[model samples]
Target: MTWKSLKTVLASLVAVALAACSPTPSSGPEATVTVFAAASLTDALTEIAADYERDEGTRVRLSFGASGAVARQVEAGAPADVVILADPIWMDRLAAAGRLDEQRFDLLANSLVVIAPVDAAASQDVFEALSGGGRLAIGTPESVPAGAYARTWLQATGRWKAVQDRLVFAADVRGVRAFVARHEAALGIVYRSDVVGQDAVRIVLEPPPEEQPAIVYPAAGAADGGAEGRALLDYLRTPRAAAIFRLHGFEPVA
Candidate 1:
């Protein structure tokens, strides 16, 4: 072969080898991560997810719903990459079920509060407000952590029985807020974080710190997650994410 023909044949061989070494379409860039977080975390996580997306150049698909409902979805094999919940028990359950990574930690803490409409003169006293008039709104004890905490506090204070009859249960903490905001209930018990930036409602009372049940959010990587999910999970532990949580009224785990 002539010198030019030899050079051309070598170049063609190199091109064929390089093509063979390339990854297939399925092995190319990673897909966006899908995260399931609690309803109360909607605002803060949305901001955090945006920052994560911008910084990592990986898209994020966030899903916010009641902790229990979201937990059930994850348990049932939903294609979630991360799970953050208002209730730790569900996280524990998810971890136990092999749906979540074994390593999980408390993301933040919150305090419970009693709230009343901005226009109403509701008493700060739980028993007085419940016994004196309209329905009391709280999350259903079986599902919502906020409601469970509220009930535990009322019982601890020896006030559950007196107010049980007047209690109006909702699906979750946010639902309780809706009831109070709409005037459908005279009083509501919610997380301190949930009441922030509310123009239609005012916090009436909070239990003494020593007496309050511990309210914490737990987060973990999903068992079915990939490198992108793991990276986002690490980002959530950074000071920036903690700052964003604090800005939204959450107390980062100390």
Candidate 2:
């Protein structure tokens, strides 16, 4: 063949070989990671997952709810690749049942704060403010870590018995925020992050760390989710993810 002809033929073969070797364009990983996290982490974790998807080239699906509820679902065979819980107690339950892998870490910590309708005056503390006969909303002590922590704080402050008559229980921390936001309850206890951007409620009191159990968020891969699960767990340990958690009011796990 002439030189130009041979060059053209070689170029065509190279093009064909390139096409044969290249993998098909795809959206993400072959494996999908399903992360079950606490409802309080909704805002922060959503953004973090988006960043993780960008960084790792994987698709991450997040399920957020009360920590206790999430734990129960995972125990019942929910397809969770990773678990990020608001309370270590619920996580421990999963660990004891062997649902979560043994390589767990305390990812973050949070504190409880009392909020009141934004229109309300700021002079009143949580205790005296609730004395105004306003409904007091809290997470359900049975299934909500925030609610459980809030209850412990109140009882420690000697307000549980005194506030019993005015108390209202919500299924989750968001429920408590909703009640206060709508003015259905003048006051409620929720995560600081929950009330951060909300103009409908104002934080009135923050429970001292000594008044309640430290709100530690523990994370681990599910026993069945394998390498993809562990990859997600590892991603969360990165400083970028830790910064996001800190911005959302969580204390970074050292």
Give TM per candidate. 0.86, 0.88
lDDT of 1 by residue, 1-254 (tens): 99999999999999999999988777566569999988889889999989988888789999987788899999999999889999999888898899987657888999998888889865545456555578889998877888888999989988888888899999888899999999999899988888878898888887889988989999888999877788887888899999998888899996
* Tens-digit per-residue lDDT, 1-254, candidate 2: 89999999999999999999999887764667999999999988899999988888788999989989999999999998899999888988998898988779998878788899989776745567666578999999899999998888888888888888999999889999999999899889888778766788899887765675777889998988878889888888889988988787777788
Which residue runs of candidate 2 sit more than 4 Å off their true CA positions?
1-29
Tell me how many clashing residue pairs each candidate has: 0, 0
Cα-based RMSD of the predictions, in order?
Answer: 4.3, 2.8
What TM value does model 2 have?
0.88
What C-alpha lDDT values do all the predictions have?
0.87, 0.87
